[model samples]
Target: MVRTLLALKGALVRGALAQLLAAEDDIDVVGEADTPDELRSALRAERPDVAVVDGDLVTADQLGDLASDRPAGCPDGGPPGRLLVLVQQRRAARLGPVLAQHSRRIGFLSHDVAPGRIVEGVRQLADGRVVLDPDLVVAALAVADSPLTPREREVLDVAAEGHPVRDIAERLVLSAGTVRNHLSRIMAKTGARTRLEAVRIARESGWI
Candidate 1:
């Protein structure tokens, strides 16, 4: 049986990817959206067998926060239609929350992977199977035991943007001393000697 697919926007790369997938015998490209709002509309309207998305379409800073708030099931516990994601290496680390929430139906692929490999991932998702890039999985697993709390992550996220202690404190409504304390703990947890190093570690490990 032929499977229908809905693709979310990326750059020229995703257009090329659509062409590649459309050429597949078992897959039919059903819809494409250039924004998250449009994607939501297409998802409801098309209800394709598989939804292909580019990672940047989402603006959530931490999937862990979102996943924790919602049930660890499909929204409304509906049919387990698959979601295939194409993400950059750095952003791939953020997928741990999604993995925990939707284990077997979601797939992740590096944007730089070969078209043949990406088509294989799409086919796997369409067949009701899960697929994740090996290196991205390893990165997710490595950061699974993160020591920082959500508040700490927020503090570090501000710090990551080159903000000063006073500025981070003001943004989070905490005092400068409290912000410094959080940074100190973050450094200890990540084993970084300085705040900048800590931010680097957190980003690389997908903690932020």
Candidate 2:
């Protein structure tokens, strides 16, 4: 079984995750703490296999303190797993550099992820890897209808080619539904009803 540590705010959020993880045969909720202090204590004592830390737990020096050492397995014997941050929203831009700086040590997830997805993330993070839910990733990239990034522009360009979401998704290595969803968002941003119209407007406005 994978031993886990949960560091989140809000009684409700903690309760929900606790119940869900408790039911999993493969997961063991070794510790639960509310703030940075309590969380630090729990971490030191438990040395959990994976740490699902909410962004609210700490930041800057406090956050750095918690992350002072790499993730370690329970009992402090085997190599450490990983520390995954659960944020209220995607802090992609802000975390991009930080994550790069600590590539093998950090990962992120949205606080609203489904229970099953959260468990799955625990398994992955405990094994040391990056895992961000797709829908949240899309939402993060689509903020500020004001503009789209070059990568988003590329996703939109390939999606608008009438490639049929499935084929386009295959070509882009994105889920079919994700491709369609991106097209819908692109349409909304450009104030166009159809894919072609959206592409034309986006191109003219230099959004792509």
Candidate 3:
């Protein structure tokens, strides 16, 4: 059967993948989108068998949105199609939690993978199969045993935005000293020499 596809537009690499997939006799490139709004619009208008999305379209906080939009199951659980995100290894940890939960219909590959791999991934997604890069999976599992708590993660997330401890305290309704204590513990847990390093670790691990 001929499969329809929509690629969320971003890096030039995605364009190459689109052209490669379009060359396949069994696949048709139906649309391309540059933003989330455009992607949604194309989804409604094209009704393709699969959507090739950029990792930039997904945020750490949108885990619920991805899950709600496409629950964790096979072809019958949620929408009619699936999603294939182009995530780099650097972003794998941040993208892990969501990936772990929604591995059924949602798939991902490294951004720098070969065109043939991308074509194969698209075909798999069109066939209602899940495709996750092995390296991405390994990176995801490496951070699975995170040592930070939700409150600590929130603190680090605020710190990551270049906020001062006092400002983070005010935002979280905690005292400045309490925030410092949290940061101290966070540093210990993450083995980070400084608050900034802790924040970086948390951000990379999707802890925040």
Candidate 4:
């Protein structure tokens, strides 16, 4: 049997999906989680063959951590199992980095896909295959190529939250001067006359 875990935000959705997948003779619903922490705990406890996660419930960084060979909470430091993320097309760009890092082991599907598709996706992922929705593929590709370096992106991400240079520095543990320098580079790369404009451009372009 293919052991599966469901990690969506809604209790009703989780229960419904569990019932759907459990109806398959070859599939078993091993566990369910409604939050990132619960997902981690369930992953460590069940060590399932596949995990179906809602993209809205976890950030890209959290997904990256879970996608690592030895994910957080895994006592034996073993693989955390394959992931099939249910994400909206608009939010797909945020997954670029993690998808690039764990291409083969992770798959993406539209959040609103038919229930049968999700069930089939779990089987495919368990068999070591990658499944990607065409619309999400296009959405991921449509994200503008980011000119800013990773550090600049980090600075801009904090800046996007309306944080000042000093706050950004403190949050990122960088010197204030360094943060200012990063901001300057970000503005130049984005060709924006002001920091707010830069943040707007970066956000609209899905660079941050």
What TM-score do all the candidates reach, one by one?
0.66, 0.57, 0.66, 0.72
- The residue pairs in collision within model 3 are none
Tens-digit lDDT string for candidate 1 (72-126) = 2447744635677777766554556676676576678887888798778877877
lDDT of 1: 0.69
lDDT (Cα, tens digit) per residue for candidate 2, span 1-208: 8888888888898888888998999989988888777877787778887778886455523454455564345455444446777765523333333444554655677777667878888888777767765544544344345365434555665555566778766655668788777777777767888888877776555444
- The list of candidate 2 runs beyond 4 A from truth reads 70-81, 133-208
Candidate 4 residue-wise lDDT, 1-208, digit = tens = 9999999988999999999999999999999998888988888788889999998777666788787746556567666699899997766766677777887788999999999999999999999988889888766655458786656766776687788888877766789999989888888989999999998998788775
For all predictions, the C-alpha RMSD in Å is 6.0, 13.8, 6.4, 4.6
Clashes of 4: 0
Model 1 residue 95 CA deviation (Å) reads 1.9
Task: Give the local distance difference test score of model 3.
Answer: 0.71
Candidate 1 stretches with Cα past 4 Å from truth are 1-8, 59-80, 149-198, 204-208
Which prediction has the highest lDDT against the true structure? Answer: 4
TM-score of 3: 0.66
lDDT of 2 at 149: 49
Clash pairs of candidate 1?
none
Clashing residue pairs for model 2: 71-80
Worst 10-residue lDDT window, candidate 1: 63-72
